[model samples]
Target: MIMDANTIKDELKKVGISINDIYDLVNTKESYPLAIPVLLDLLQKGIEDVKIKEGIIRALAVKEAIGKASPILIEEYHKIAKDKMMLRWAIGNTIYVTITENDVDSILQIVQDDENGMSRQMFVLALGKVKSEKAEDILIKLLDDEELTPHALEALGRLKSKKAKSKIEILTKHPKSLIKKEAEKALKKIG
Candidate 1:
């Protein structure tokens, strides 16, 4: 049964149902689209609860509702500090899911401005998803970065840029087995 927004809100008010329980229900039923407005409202309320905000972000990501929630997520991203890695990761990933041609420059700027490896990785992954030649070029430059190589390689593969084929072939012999395996996989994908 499809639960309407009002019913979902009413259910949340019940004594026994927790936010987590609601999250599970939403996930199991694949009903996150229905909950987008509610989640956005909760996020906007400044609930001051890290766990709740995290859950809201996760739900948005699962539902692929990032386009609708981008403004709020971007606001939350600015409000968050680099030290809060997990929350930053969640927010970054959500921003990533909504990436578009318009967001490419800003995303690159965020990657350059942020020193956090994890945050940079998420942004690079997002760049890969953009499937633009510019994004492909950026990922190629990042291939030599120890912290970003795996993600960059994965993104390049996702783009299937024939130009990246040679570089990926070189990585096939990398000392790290994981990198080598990923490179080989990316090579196959590019082919």
Candidate 2:
């Protein structure tokens, strides 16, 4: 059964997402088997409420939603300029879970922008899911990023990036135990 706007809103409310409007629900006649595109369209149309947008983004994090939502989510990630922690984390988590090889370039673009801060943390780690040499190089350079160094180490290890082995080695003795732990884990993976 196709859910109407009110039904969608009610469902969202049930999950603690109390929103006033259902911004652009898909047409009832459309053949979309899933609600992913409807949610992605709202995100693309620029929902102003961070919480609502975050809810939609998180809802679309499922594996079935990846091909349809990844590009739109990346677009939304770029659109966010403020330091909204929950929203940023939501996007990062969604992208991290759904990220594909095709999304690597865009993820790299976002990760390279230091202004995005730790919001890019999950994106850094998501790079591990793709085995691109570009991803490996970027992860290596990200070793210099204090906030993302641990995630970078983890991603390189996921890639089993022999190229990054030396950089990962340097972090093994990092002052932060978390960094040291990740560095060791990454080295084990690389080996």
Candidate 3:
């Protein structure tokens, strides 16, 4: 089943993947090459990982694979998150991927939904990875969403957006001490 680069390319051509795809899979900033095959195989089988380590390697590769991934591949991953255990996937995926600014924006928008708090939280933490102006409004909006406050504050702290100062300050007065603490931390960073 092993072959040279050309053989691998020919075999993959029949499946619609290519050598450049391999480059993206293995060349991410994170060491994800080790997981690429497992993740791709899992996706092809349309199965979800029940444990973190069960597919941890693959998850890491999938994460980095998104860094320069084609939009179609990104969408495919998004679909996988939606159709499966999204929270778990996000938590697992974040460790290995360095997705683009667009992926961060897409996640922020999706987390706006009330039922997607896990995604919201994951997206918040992920802002630490791909900080951008697109995340500014979304992070600020979390101030009004009681459930997202903590994660939002974390995102704001990491994102360091100038506009976040006003929104972050308001959280310092939140009834929940935990949120207030997070807000205080975010405001400190904003300054």
lDDT of each: 0.72, 0.78, 0.57
Instruction: State residue 150's C-alpha deviation in candidate 2, in Å.
Output: 0.9
Backbone clashes in model 3, listed as residue pairs: 63-97, 64-97
**Total backbone collisions, model 3:** 2
Per-candidate TM equals: 0.79, 0.82, 0.64
Please report the candidate that would top TM-score against the real structure. Answer: 2
Q: Which ten contiguous residues of candidate 1 have the minimum total lDDT?
A: 1-10
lDDT value, candidate 3, whole model: 0.57
Tens digits of lDDT, candidate 3, 6-26 = 443454466555444344434
lDDT string for model 2 (97-174, tens) is 788889989999989988888888999989999889898899999999989988999888888899988878888988
Tens digit per residue, CA lDDT, model 1, 55-96:
667777754575677677767776877888888888778776
Candidate 2 residue pairs that clash: none
